[model samples]
Every structure is written in structure tokens, then in C-alpha cells.
Target: MRLVVFDVDGTLVDSQHHIIRAMTAGFAAAGLEPPPRAEILGIVGLSLPVAVAQLLPMADLATQARVVEAYRVSYMQARGERAAPLYPGALDCLDRLSARDDLLLAVATGKSRRGLDAVIAAHGLQGRFVSLQTADGHPSKPHPSMLWQALADAGCEARAALMVGDTSFDIQMARAAGMPGYGVTWGYHPAEALDAAGAALIAEDFHHLTRAIEDWAS
Candidate 1:
């Protein structure tokens, strides 16, 4: 079966505001300033610790940990206030892709297992993904660990799988895993960056992305 692995934050859901707000809280809790909006979005696909470290390279481990904890708490609280919504055509695209018997859907995200669970619960996406690889056990994006686990879980080869995401880290990870990465324009990263990262196809919308996946499969 062909596998389609997706990134959650920017790829499927529009969580920019949620992320920015929680990041503000996290940095505040650490007595530091949050990075710029672009900087925050730039690190969207990386694991929390890794992302935090990038944002605060000079900070001590304790400070980074505190930031991570605060970000988690604030994010969860924000979730209770308003769950992140999927992109305009996200659900429709999922429905179409998941309906195929020969295709399997999976998620490879920097989000914790708990966070991923919240997303699934909120979106009524139970049993929607054959593989759910999260940051809890794996190294962050660009490490290839998450995609490796996902491929193993679905009994699919790397060449038969496609990674769909919105960042350079995702493309980098897919490259390391021996698969092609499809970049989404609406996500955090720009098309130029995705191209530089060696994305096989950078799509503007889910319709074109879906069609591109089909073409690749065919």
C-alpha cells in the first residue's frame, strides 16, 4: 500500500495563532522574550525541545525545559478555549485519500502523543491514521526516526510513501528516509525554501496536492 504521512500543525491545521500565543506565555514564564512570528513559524516542524533550543540557543537547559513546560500548559489551555481548525480543504482531502483501499494515511508530527491525541479527538479522526508517530519517543523532525517508524507500522517501503508537510525539516526528514516530500504552500515555510530543501512537488492547495499524490501513485 502507498503511505501518505502528514505534518499536523501547519500542514493540516491552522495553529499559527495558538502557537504564537502559547509561545508568548512560554517565553514569559521563562522570563525571556518570544521569537518573532516568522521565527516561531519557521520552526514549526521541529520537536518542542529542539524548536525551543533553536529559538533560545544561549539559554541553559533548565530555562529551555521551563519554556517547554510552559508552552505545553498554555497550548493545552488554549485548546480548551478553542481547538485548532483544519485548513479549508484539509478534511475533504483526508476523506478522499483515506477512502482508498490501496492507500494508507499516517501522521508524523513534532507534537507529543498527548497533543496528537487532542488533535484526533477534536477532529473526530479516530482510527484515521494507520501510524501515529509523535515526538514522545522519536527524535525531532529531519531525523527520519518518525518516518521510519511510520513506514514500519504500515508495512510500507520508504519509496512507496510520501511526506506531506509545510517546512524544510519535513522535506529534510523525508529525504533522509528515502522518500519524496510534497510541500504545501499555505503552511509556514515559503515555496522558495521548500524548493531549496529538495521538495519533489510544492503544491498551492489540497486539490493539486491530492492530484499530485495520485499521479505519483499511478
Candidate 2:
């Protein structure tokens, strides 16, 4: 059977507002300044610590860690206020993919296990994925560990797996894991960035993405 691995934020859902707001709180808690919106969004697919470090390169490790914790708290609070919504057609695409008997769906994301769980619970996506790899147990994206573990969990070979996401880190991670990566345009990064990161195809929307995945599988 083939495996289709997905990214969470900026892929299936739009968490930019919550992310930016939490990041602002994180910086506030740390008595620092948050980066610009574009700069912050640029690191959407990375683990908390890694993303924090990128945003605060000059800060000490302790401060970065503090910001990470604060971000987590703020995110959880914001999440309760408003759950991030899935992009239009995401459910339909997932439904279509799930209907296929020859494939298994999985998630490989930078979100912590708690955060991923929250999203899944909020969206009633329990049992939607055969494997769920998160930052809690794996390195951030652009590292192949999550995808490697996902392959093992899904009993899929790298050649038989497809990675679908919106960021360069996702494409790079898929490349490092020896899998073909498909990019979605409606997410965080631009199409050029994804193409530069070695995406096999850049889909315009979920409908196009589902078709692309099916075409690739065939």
C-alpha cells in the first residue's frame, strides 16, 4: 500500500493568526520583540525551539526556552478561544484519499503532540491518520526522522510514499527521506520557494492536489 503523509499547519489548516498572536505573546513574556508577520510565518513548519531560536538568534538559550514555553501557553489559550480551521476542500480531499483502499494517510508535522492532538480533537480527525509524527518525538521539519518513522509506522517504503505540504522544510524533508514531495500553493510559502526546495508538483488547491496525488500514485 502507498502512504500519503501530510503537514499540519499551513497545509491542512490555517494557523497563521494564532501562531502570530502566540508568538507576540511569547516575545512579550520574554520581554522581547516579535518578528514581522512574514518573518514569523517563514518558520511555520519548524519546531518551537528551532523557530524561536531563528526569531531570536541573538538571545541566550535560556531566553529562547522561556519563549518556547510562553508560546505554548499562549497557543493553547488562543486555541481554546478559536480552533484553527481547515482550509476549504481539505476535508473533501482527505475524504477522497481515505476512500482509496490502496493507500494509508499519515501526518508528519512540527506541532507538539499536545498541539496536534488538540487540532485533531477539535476537527474530529481521530483515526484519520494511520501515523502521527510530531515535534514532541522527532526533530523539526527538513530532518527526515519524522518521515522515516512515519514510513515505518505505515509499513510503507520511501518510494511508495508521498509528502504533501506547504513549506520548503516539508519539501526538503521529503527529499531527504527519498520521497516525492507535493506542494500546495494556498499555504505559507510561495510556489517558487517550494519549487526551489525540490517539490515534484505544486498544486493550486486541494482538488488539484488530490488529483495530483492520484496521478502520481498511478
Candidate 3:
């Protein structure tokens, strides 16, 4: 079966606002200034600790760890106050893709297993994926470990799998894993960055994303 692996944040769900807010609170709790929204968006596909390190390159490891914990607490609190909704057409695309018997679906995300589980349950997406690889057990995005584990779990070859996401990290990871990557414009990173990162094609919307995948599959 052909495998389709997807990213979570900035890919399926639009959690930018909540992410920015929580990150701001996190930095505040850590007694540091928050980075710009654009800067934060650029790091969406990375694991929390790695992302925090990038955001606070000048800070020591202890400081970064504190920021990570603060961010997690802040994010958990924010989740109670607001839900991060899937972008329009995201569910439809997933539904259509899942209906194809020749295809297998999976998730390769930088989110922790608990976070991924929460999103799946919150969106009622349980059982839709055949494999779920998360930061809890694997290295962060752009490392290719998540994709490698996902492909192994699905028993699929690299060439038979595609990574779908919105960031350069995803595209680079797919490349490193010897697979094609498809970028969706409605997500985090800019289209130009996606293209530069070796995306085979960039889809402007879910309809285009579906068509692009089908075209590749055919």
C-alpha cells in the first residue's frame, strides 16, 4: 500500500494563534522576551525543546528547559480556553484519502505522543491512521527518524510514501528519507521556502492538495 504521512501542527490544524499566545506566555514565565510571530511560525515543525533552543539561542540549557515546561503548561491551559480547528477542507481531504483502499495513512509529527493523542481524540480522528510517530519516541522534524519509523510501521518503501506538510523541515525530512514531499500553502511556512526546500509541488488549497496527491499516485 502507498503510505501518506502527515504533520500535525501547521499542517492539519491551524494552531498558530494559540501557539503564539502560549509561546509568549512561556517566554514571559521564563523571564525572557518572546520572539516574533513569524519567527515562531518558522519553527513549528520542530520538537518543543529544539524549537525553544532555536528561539533562545543565547540562553543556557537550563533556561531552555524552563521555557519548554512553561510553554507546555501555557499551551495546556490555552487548550482548555480554545480549540485549534482544522483548516477548511482538511477533514475532507483526509476523508477522501482514507477511503482509498490502496493507500495507508499515518502521522509523523514533532508533537509529543500525548499531544498527538489529544489532537486525534479531539478531532475524532482515531483509527484513521495506520501509524503514528511522534517526538516522544523519535527525533524532531528534518531528522528523518519520524518518517523512517512511520514507513517501517506501515511496511512501506520510501519511494511508495509521501510526506505532506507545510514547512521546510517536513520537505527536508522527506528528502532525507528518499521520498517526495508535498507542501500546503495554507499552513505555516511561506510557499517560496517550501519550494526551496525541494517540495515536488506546493498545493494552494485542499482541493489542489488532493489532486496533486492523486496525480502522483497515478
- Which residue ranges in model 3 land beyond 4 Å of their true spot? none
Please write out the lDDT profile of model 1 over residues 120-151, one tens digit for every residue. 99999887799999999999989999999999
lDDT of 2 at 94: 90
Over all chains combined, what TM-score does candidate 3 have?
0.98
Residue pairs clashing in model 3 are none
165 Cα displacement, candidate 2 (Å): 0.6
Give candidate 3's error at residue 7 in angstroms: 0.7
Model 2, position 103, has a per-residue lDDT of 83
Q: Summing lDDT over every window of 10 consecutive residues in candidate 1, give the lowest-scoring window.
A: 209-218
Error of 2 at 193 (Å): 0.7
Question: Considering only N, C-alpha and C atoms within 3 Å, which residue pairs clash in candidate 1?
Answer: none
Predicted candidate 2 versus true structure: per-residue lDDT over 77-171, tens digit per residue: 99999999999999998988988999899999999898999999999898879999999988888999999999999989999998999999999
Count of residue pairs whose backbone atoms collide, per candidate = 0, 0, 0
TM-score for each model: 0.98, 0.98, 0.98
Report RMSD for candidate 3: 0.8
In model 3, how large is the Cα lDDT of residue 16?
A: 90
User: RMSD in angstroms, candidate 2?
Assistant: 0.7
Worst 10 residues of 2 by lDDT: 209-218
